[model samples]
Target: MRLSLNQWTTRRWSVAEAVDGCVRHGLEAIGLWRQNVAEQGLAESVKLVRDAGLRVSSLCRGGFLTTSGKAFAEALDDNRRAIDEAAELEAACLVMVVGGLPGVQPGEPLTAGASRDLAGARERVAEALAELAPYAGERGVKLALEPLHPIYCPDRAVLSTLGQALDLALAHPEEQVGVVVDTFHVWWDPRVFDDIARAGRRIASYQVCDYLHPLPEDVLLGRGMMGDGVIDFKPITRAVLDAGYTGDVEVEIFNADIWAADPDEVVATMKARYEDVVLSRP
Candidate 1:
C-alpha cells in the first residue's frame, strides 16, 4: 500500500506536526484538511510538507453546493479558494463532498418548503460541478467527487454512490474531474465491485477505513480503524488495484477515540494496520 495519513485521522496534529509524524513513520504522503492548512497559513503549510519531502495526496474537501442565495455563493467562493490551496500544496486532487438538502443548518430545523428532495439536490450539485470544473482544471486541480453513504444522503451528501459520482465526473473531461473510492462509505453497496471496475482511470483517490459497530450519537465520528470492523479488505482492495489506480492509499478515519489517542501512536497503529490488512491482498 502507498500509505498516506489523512489529517482528520489525527485531528490534533498541526500540519507541521503531521508532516513530521509521517516522516517519522516512513510515510511519504498525507491528506490535508482545509482548516489545518488555513491555521498554518497556505504558504507555510505547503512549505512545511514540501520541506519534509511529503506529498499532499488530496485536499479534504471543496463542496457544499446545495444551499441557495448567499450560502451557495459563499460555498463557491470557498471552493475556489480550496482549489487554489490544493494547487499551491501540489495536491493530486480536491475531494468534494457535495451537500445534501437545503435549510438544514447544523443545529437548526428544516424549514417548511425545504423538505428532503434527493433528486433536486443532486441536480444542483451537478450544476455546481459544471461551474467549477473549468476553474479547477485551469488551476491544475482535479475535482474528486466522493459519494458518501446513502445514510448521509438526507443531511450530508446527495451523491451517495460511486456510480452517481462517476456520472457527474463523466459529464466533464476525465482530467478535470474524477471519483473517490472510499471503502468506509461505499463498502455496503451491492455493486461496489462493479463500480470500482467501471470507475477505472476516473478514480482519482482511494481511501481506506473500517466500518465498526455501536454507532456514536454523532454518527460522523463512527468510522473504525482498518482492521477493526467487519469490512473484508482483500476484495475491495483487489478491485481498486485491478482498476489501475496508482495514487496514494489514504487512511481517513473519524472516530473520536482515534482522535483522542496520541498522534504518533495513531500513525504507528495505522501503518501497522495498513501493512497487515490493506497491503496484505494487493
Candidate 2:
C-alpha cells in the first residue's frame, strides 16, 4: 500500500511546506485540512500538491451535527462547501469527523450528562450523514466516517468503534458512505480485525500512527510508531489487505511535540518508521 501524511502533523507549517516535506520524503500522498486550504486558497493549494506529484488521499474533515436550527443549517452549508473543495482538489475521499454531544462545542463548557447521551448523538450523526450522503455521491466523493477513539466520544465523535462505523456505512451503502480506519484510534480495539474484515473494500482510507501512551492528545508518531505501540500492525494491515483495501496508509499523529519540530524531519522519520514497522511486514 502507498504511504500518505496528514496535514494535522504539520499544522504549524503552510500547505506548501507540508507538501514539500511529504514529497521530499517520498510519500505517495497527503491529507489536507480545510482550515489550511482556506489559508492557502483552495485552488493554489491544489496546484501546489499536484505540481509536487502527490495524491490528495482525503480531506481532513467535514461534519458537525450537534445543534439544530440555524447552527445545523450552517454546518450543512459548510459541509457542502467542503465537498466542492475536495472535488476541486481531486481528493480520493472526504473524511468525516462526525460531531458529538447535543450542545458541546470544542473547547467549550461541558454539560453534566453529555456523555450519557451517546445514543442520541450517534442518531444525530447518522441522520446528518444520511442527509449529506446524496450530495457527496452526486459529486463522486466518498464520505469516510472516521470513528474517533472513546477518549473523544464525550466531546468529539460518538462513533468510537470500527464496528459502529461499518454499521453506519452499511446503513447508507447506496450513498457511497465508507469507513476511515485510523490505527491510533482503533489499534487497541479487540474487534479491530473482525471489523476490518467486515469493512472490506468499503474501507475508504487507512491511517497510521503510534502513541507512546493512551492520552487524550499530544501523542507523537515516533512514540507510537507502528510496532513500538502495543498494536500488532502487521496483522491489522494483513486483515485490511485481505479484505481488498488498496488505499493509502495515511500517517496522522496529533502530537504537539512533533509539530514543534521541523516538518521535514517529522516526515522523514515517519516514512522510515512506517517502512520498517508497517511496510516491512507480510
Candidate 3:
C-alpha cells in the first residue's frame, strides 16, 4: 500500500522538512499544498521532494471557478499556473475544489444577487473544466475534482457528491479528468459506496480523514485523524481498492489541534492509524 502524508496534516512543517519527515516515517508519497510550495519556490520544492525520493500523490487544489467577470478570469489564470506547477512536480493529479455560489457564507442564509444562482455556478464550473482539461492533458496532468460535503455547499464547493464529480469527469477524456474520494467528505453520503464502484479508473485521488461530531465553529477544522472519528475505514478502503485505483492513499487532515502538534509526532500517528484502519482491510 502506498500511503501519502498531505502537507496540510502537518501544516507547521516547511516543504523541505515535510519531505524529510515523510522519509523518516518510511513513506514515499506526499500530498502538497500550494501555499507551502509557493513559499519554497516551485522549482526548489520540486527538487527538494525529488532528492528526498518522495512522490507527490496529488496537488492540494486548483479551482474556484464559480464567480464571473475579471474575478473568474483570474481564477482560470491561477488554475493554469497550478497545472504547470503540477506538471513540473510530476504530481499524480491537480485536485480541483470547484467553488460554490460566490459571496455565500457557510452555514448562513444565502444572500440574493448574482452569486445566488447555484445552477449558474455549476454551469460555470463545467465551462471552466472544459477550458482547463485540455491544458492539463497536454502537460500530462489529470484534473481531479473533489466534492466537498453538503454542509460546505453554500460556499466551499459546488460539487457535493462522488457521482456528481464523476459526471463532470465523464465530459472529458478519462486521462484528463478524474474524481477524488475523501472519506471525511463522502462518508455520510448514502450513495458513496455505489459511487465508488462506479468511479472505477476515474478515481484519481483518495484522501483519508475521519469526521468528528459537534463540528468546530470553523467546520473546516473538524477533520479527525483516521480511526479517531466515526468512519469505518475497512469497507471504504476495500471499495476504493476494488475499484482498480492503484494510487497512494493520502492522509489529509485540516484540524487545528493536529496542526498544533509536532510534525514528526503527527506523521507517526498518521502511519499508525493508517495501518490499523485503512490498511487492515480484508
Candidate 4:
C-alpha cells in the first residue's frame, strides 16, 4: 500500500510547498484540498504535482447539498467546478462531504433556526448524488462519499456511517461514485468491518487518523495520528485490505498540534507512525 499525505494534515503549507515536501519524503501520493488549489491557482497546482511525480489520491471535497432554490443551484455549480478542478489535477476522486441541515455550515454549532429533520437532509444528499454522479463520471472523476462522525451530522455530513455511505453510493455506477473508509469516523461503529468488507472495490479512499479521547474543544480538530489515540489500526486496516482496496492509505489528521509542527517533520512522523501502526496489520 502507498502512503498518501492528505494536504489537510499539513494545513499550513502552500500547494507548492506541500508537493515539494511529498517528493522529499518519497511519498507517492498527496490529497489536494480545493482551497489550497485555489490559493496556488489550479494550473500551477496541477503542474507542481505532475512535475514532482506525485499522484493526487483524491481531492478534499465537493459536496454540500442541503440548500434549496438559488443556494442549491449555486451549490451544484460550485461542485461542478470542484469536479473540473479534480479532473485538471488528474485526481482519483473528489471526496464528497455531503452537507448537513439546509442552512448549517461545517464545524459550526447548530442554531435553533437550523432544520432538525435528519431524514430530509439525507434525501438532499441522495438527490445530489443523482445530479453530480453523471457529471463526475463524464470527467472520469468519481465522487468519493465520505461519512463524517455522528457528531457532525448537524453541521457536516448527514451520512454518518460506512454502511450509510455505501448505500448512498450504490445508486450510482461504481465508476461514478464510491465510499471513503475513514477510520477516524467509522472506527466506533459495530458494523465497521462488515461495511468495510462490503465496500470492496467501491472504497475510493482509506483515510487513517485516530479518534482522540476527550475530543478537542473543537470536535473537528480531534483526529490524532495513527498511534496516538485509542484506535487499533491493525484490525481496521486489515479489514480495509481484505475488502480489496488497492489504493493510497492517506494520513488525514486534523489536530492543531500536528498542523503547527514543521511540515517536513509532520511528513516524517506520518511515515513512521504509518509503518508502526497501519502497516502492522497483515
**Best by TM-score, which number?**
4
Q: For candidate 3, lDDT tens digit of each residue in 135-156? A: 9999999999999998888787
Lowest summed lDDT window (length 10), candidate 4: 103-112
lDDT (0 to 1) per candidate: 0.89, 0.81, 0.91, 0.91
For candidate 2, the TM-score is: 0.92
Residue ranges of candidate 3 with Cα displaced over 4 Å? 105-114
Candidate 3 worst ten-residue window by lDDT: 105-114
lDDT per residue as tens, model 1, 116-219: 77778887898888889999999999999999987677677888899999988999998899999999899999988999999899999999999888667877
Task: Judge candidate 3 at residue 3 and give its lDDT.
Answer: 95
lDDT of 1 at 278: 81
Candidate 2 lDDT over 88-140, as tens digits, reads 89898999988877677565667664445767778877778878888998888
Q: What is the lDDT of residue 119 in candidate 1?
A: 76
Query: Which candidate ranks first by lDDT, i.e. highest?
Result: 3
